[model samples]
Target: MVRRVVVVGIVLAVVLTPLMGWAQSKAVLPPIMPLRDIKPGMRGIGRTVIQGQKIEEFDIEIMGILQGGGDVIPVRHLILFRASGPVTDRSGGTAAGMSGSPLFINGKLIGALSAGYLWQPGKRELALGTPIEDMLTVLDLPNGTAQTPWPRTFAASEPFHIGRRAITRVVVTDTLAQAQRVDEAGLPGMTAFIPATFPVMVSGLSPRAMGFLRQALGAAQPLLQYDQEGATFVASPITGGSSVGILQVRGDVSYGGMCTVTLRVGDRLLICGHPWDQMGEVEYALTTSDIVTVVRTLQEPFKEGNLGDLIGKIDQDRGPAIRGVIGRMPRMLAVRVAVTDLDAGTRIEKGVQVVRRRDLAKTFAAAMALTAVDRARGQILGGGTASVKITLRAKGLPRVISRENVFYNSRDVALASLLDLPDALNFLLYNDLAPLDPVDMNIEISVTGKRQTAAIAETTVERREVAPGERLRVHMTLRPFQEQTVPSRVIEISIPRDFPRGPAVLVVGSAGRQVSLESAPEQGLAQLLQQEPQPSPAATLDGAIQLFEDYGKNTDILLQLIPFGLPPEGSEFVKFDVFAGEVVRTDWVVQGEIQIPILIR
Candidate 1:
């Protein structure tokens, strides 16, 4: 039969008074028992203070215990209850400010006070605690080794930029809103709350361009109101209340499109996630007469308001609510490029563009094609005039290239020109799309080539549902000079699900020969036809641990912990660690935390 669990509350407070006198006075008393020795009904005295007055009188009792263990240490549990104590202010009992109050059972450190009930009332209240055993799990001491010390404190580091470009800011907006009644009368009310509204500002570009954008915005009369099933309203959404309003507005700008502008709300300022590449000061103003819809009722009576009233109170002082001077125009495309050569080349280098746009596939293809041409042939070619033929090679589709058919003269030519295929394919796939329908396409290119001849190639197209964190592994076997079973190196490409599909690097090896190739979708499998491969780091748990240890020496905080429960029978426990760095001067921190999976054989 299962036993019922009893839940009780405890109150705790921390005193920061000097320990010298108390230490001496308590020397003769029996040494406080360690947390492990405490049991239910055990009584103890807690010393604390209230409002600057030193008080050493409070009563505590052990209520229950919790237990958990692992390979390294056994965790301890000590649940305590407050029998009597006037230790803190009435409103401050277990307040938010007291998150980590140390608890002692018979003078033994047992757990940290974590939570309490606000409705319990008076000096005798209940509180919950995280047992010392939980802390042991955090410290990776499942077996309870005395040598391992728990980290006294932990702090989150500021996010860092590790890739080629910094992720300055990512703004997400809600596209739909639904209304619910907060009161019985069903009258129109605030559905959403405006945290604060500052002038929407634009800067960085030439005065002519800025003026043109302003004019376009003013003349277009775009609606920025909250819409609920075609109904409109005019009020900021109330906190925790049900109403409909604009969800959010997100904007970000980076290199290749960096321009500075300052948005001000009185003395406040708005800037990018990170410092701008270029800095300057400029005045900002709200683009006037912007339409904003607000949904006031679930029924027929919806209201509409202008941007000004939606953001600012009519009776309050209103200047630019946002302030500061740094940032560029939002980008429409994430990776932009201009290419000069569409035909062929071994090494390619070109400029890249990052911008915002409605169609990412179209923008990405255009930029990639341009960059490929510029790097290969050294001149920008007209992509619009290129008559590109795309074939979907599948079980039932027509073949673009086949093993028995040679489409080009030489394999070198095939591989060199294959760098621009993704762009062509993307362009072909998304040339025309309906407003409500999403264009989706997936294709794989297989190329067979010889130095003297472009032997054969094929494109396989199919619809694939790709979700985040999904892994796609491409297996390639290289056969040079028609020799079967040549010794070839295998390189795996790990495309992070979050990363956009664009220019990517791949390594292939055959007969001890390695080659590096510039790859995009349009170039297809041709660019990889005859190239050698290069060495790549192993993507394994042990490999990752070694890499972190080598490069993470400078990290400020390092935590190694074993998970709860021992490895299954015949299996080894997996070790995990979390590393973090903090720069005190800038209040910046970088965290690298991952769980390493290990198999015990």
Candidate 2:
């Protein structure tokens, strides 16, 4: 009796295994309406956010498909539709952020609204979409696909062309005579389409900061739109058809692009029927967005929105769609900046987190540094001086890298102050040795209206001749800005042993010139700091850190010992086999150079 009972239970377990698996698959994926079943004149309701967080419905009437009747359908697929309703009417067209708005016919999912006609003047009723079947293929696409395509703009002309090929000219008309003219122009009415785009929302940045960021990012389209007050931190409910964001930087200052959510299956979601930068296998912060209102214009209609709380991370960027998983956050680089305005006696502190990507880390880091200074002072341009200190902590590094410098500029002082920041960050994040994880970044800046600059007026040494390995005191005088006279100071310089017993020179100059004089041909200090090439992966991280340790500051008085003879032929600067240097840091931005003749005995 016991053996019979055990055998009966085993049979029951095998019978129910496939049933359980089928139930779970059905729960994760909703029924998809195939493209073949779809017909012209079929009307569907699309979901998207027009104002606030509420998801509203819009009317979509299918006009036709791009593929003509043939034995084999072409891979190029597009669903042409005419959208109308309160949402479309208010915006005068399909807004930019509605790229991923989902279209459902009779409660069956069809596709996402991805492209539209931008040349049409007012109330662009006709639009194009990507089929849902092709969008689902993005889930199986390979990771790390390719470089992000550069944004581009078309010139104003008849029949807009892209790369010598003119897209089908499309126009909507209310009168019969106007409709007849569109057909006479040999246009393929509603066959060709272009991907839609929207400006990334930005907050807490000045115009200069935005311009610098746009240039650095090489953005053809407007990269950042300044409208929101700041970024939000609290998570909000995200559903299909709600507005979403692909965030790069968040906190007091935020930067990201907004799109509509297409579909949600369990914790997974699909957004942007088109590619999001085409950076496959990405880890960008995913957040919900709050739409303010849609602005109607002849150029293109766009939705103005602000980025809200971090809800998930986008892990895939493919041709058809971008896929993300909710509740999982991407790795972020923490940044803290403190700025003080000496003239206004105001101090401001800002904290932000940036997405960590090799292509974007340096650009965003510099933008954050500039924005902090721009926000602290009412203005950062015009005659001023700034002192800055940067501290960086990263994995695989033994100690934190710290640097301090002072800068002065007659115009745009903030930009001048952070000139070296991008180079330093580039070296830290992109060294060829090994992958590094950035831990934290801290920046402190102080700005004043008075120009804090000084020029090296004169230099004198007690003895004209000095022996090798001997120490000598050099007298120096600095002429301060608008000052009649300033006292002289002394800096001690050491002569390295084993020096040739011949004519030698003592060069006293600012740090920038010192670097140029000491650097090798085709391997300047600036190039090395910007892009460091290691011998091999086996090279120690210390080798890279040593370069930063030997670098001089802008506020430093640099002394170098070199041969007094002429440089090698075809060389503009002197190069020495055995080099010795000393540096003294001061409060002012030091400028000018003085060369003193000396002899080695």
Question: Which 10-residue window in model 1 sums to the lowest lDDT?
Answer: 1-10
lDDT of 1 at 210: 29
- In candidate 2, what are the lDDT values of residues 1-601, reduced to their tens digit? 0000000000000000011111122226667899888787899888887776677888999876654222342334667788999878886668777888888888888888877754455677667676899877765556655533322221111233333445443332322334445545654422233564445556666776676666655444345455455443332355568667777777766766777778776667778777756667888887655666676666556666555556678888765678877777888888888889999999988877887775556666667777777788777455588888888888877778877777776666766667666546765676666567788888888889898888999999999899989876898888887885468888877777877678878788877422331212112322333453333222366755654544556778777767667431211122222555567776678888888888889
Instruction: Give model 2's TM-score versus the native structure.
Output: 0.73
In order, the Cα lDDT scores of the candidates are: 0.25, 0.64
- Point to the candidate with the largest lDDT: 2
**Candidate with the greatest TM-score versus the true structure:** 2
The residue ranges of model 1 lying beyond 4 angstroms of the native Cα positions read 1-35, 47-57, 67-78, 89-92, 118-124, 133-601
